[model samples]
Target: MEPKNNLRSLDRQINVFLPAISLICILCIFISCNKQDRTTVIYGKVTDQNHQAVDSILVVAGGLWDFNIEVVKQIYTDENGNYELVIDVPKKYIKLNV
Candidate 1:
C-alpha cells in the first residue's frame, strides 16, 4: 500500500539523517573542548605603600569559582619585588580566572 511505502521511506530518511546530526553534534563538542590556553602566567611586582619594592613578598594566584578562590599557585617576590605564578586553566572555568 501507499501508506506502507511512505512509512518505509520516512524511516529510511530518519535513519540516514540521525547519524549525520549525531556526527555534527560530536564534532561541535570536540571543537569546543579543544580550547587553547597554555601560555598564561600571572606575573606582577609587589610594591609597598611607600612605592618601594617589597622583596620576599608572598604572591598568591587563585582560580575563582562562584564563591571560592581555589589557590592555584604561589611564589615569592625576588630582590626586585617581581613574582611569576604558573597555572593551567581549563575550559569549564572559562580557560582562566579573571
Candidate 2:
C-alpha cells in the first residue's frame, strides 16, 4: 500500500511539473518566433542636381514584412544635406522614399 501511494504521489508531482516545463518551452519558442532578427541604419545626403544641400526635405523609410507593412520612420536632412534613419530590419524588403 505504501509503495502504491508513493507511486501515485510521484505521478502527481510529474503531472504538475510536466505542464510547467511544457509551458516554459512553449513560451520560449513563442518569444523566439516573435523576436526581430535585424536592424537597419540609413544615412544619405539630400542634394540637388547642382550638388547643393537640400535642407528640410522629408525622407521616409517604409518597411515591408510578412505580417504587415509599416512606416519605419521619417527624417529631414540638415543644412549639411545629411539624413539618417534607424529602424528594425525589414523581414523581406525595405523601401526608402525621399
Candidate 3:
C-alpha cells in the first residue's frame, strides 16, 4: 500500500509538470517557426539617351516565384532621377523593368 501511494504521488507530480513541459515545447516551436523577411533594396538612376536625368519615370520591380510573377513594387523616379525599389524578397527572385 505504501509503494502504491508513492507511485500515485509520483504520477501526480508528473501530471503537474506535463502542462509546463508542453507549454515550453509549444513556445519553442512557435519561436522557431517564424519566417524572416529578406528585404533587398535596389538603387538606380534613370537616364535618357542624351545623358540626362529622367524624372518621374516609372520603375517596376517584380518577383519571379515558381511560375508566377508577383509585382513587388511600382515607383517613379524622384526629382534627382533616382529610384529606390525596396522589395521583401530574395535577390535571386527579383526582376526589374524600367
| Cα lDDT computed for each candidate against the true fold | 0.77, 0.81, 0.82
Clash statistics: count for each candidate: 0, 0, 0
lDDT of 3 by residue, 50-85 (tens): 989999998888777666787878899998899988
Say which candidate scores most in lDDT: 3
How many pairs of residues in model 1 come into backbone collision?
0
Full-model lDDT, candidate 1 = 0.77
Instruction: Please give the range of 10 consecutive residues that has the lowest summed lDDT in model 3.
Output: 89-98
TM-score of each: 0.61, 0.52, 0.54
| TM-score of predicted structure 1 | 0.61
lDDT of model 2 at position 81: 88
TM-score, candidate 3, is: 0.54
Superposed by TM-score, candidate 2 places the C-alpha of residue 28 at a distance from the truth, in angstroms, of 4.5
lDDT of 1 by residue, 1-98 (tens): 99999999999999999999999999999988886665568888889899898898887766656666777677899998988877776434432442
The residue pairs in collision within model 3 are none
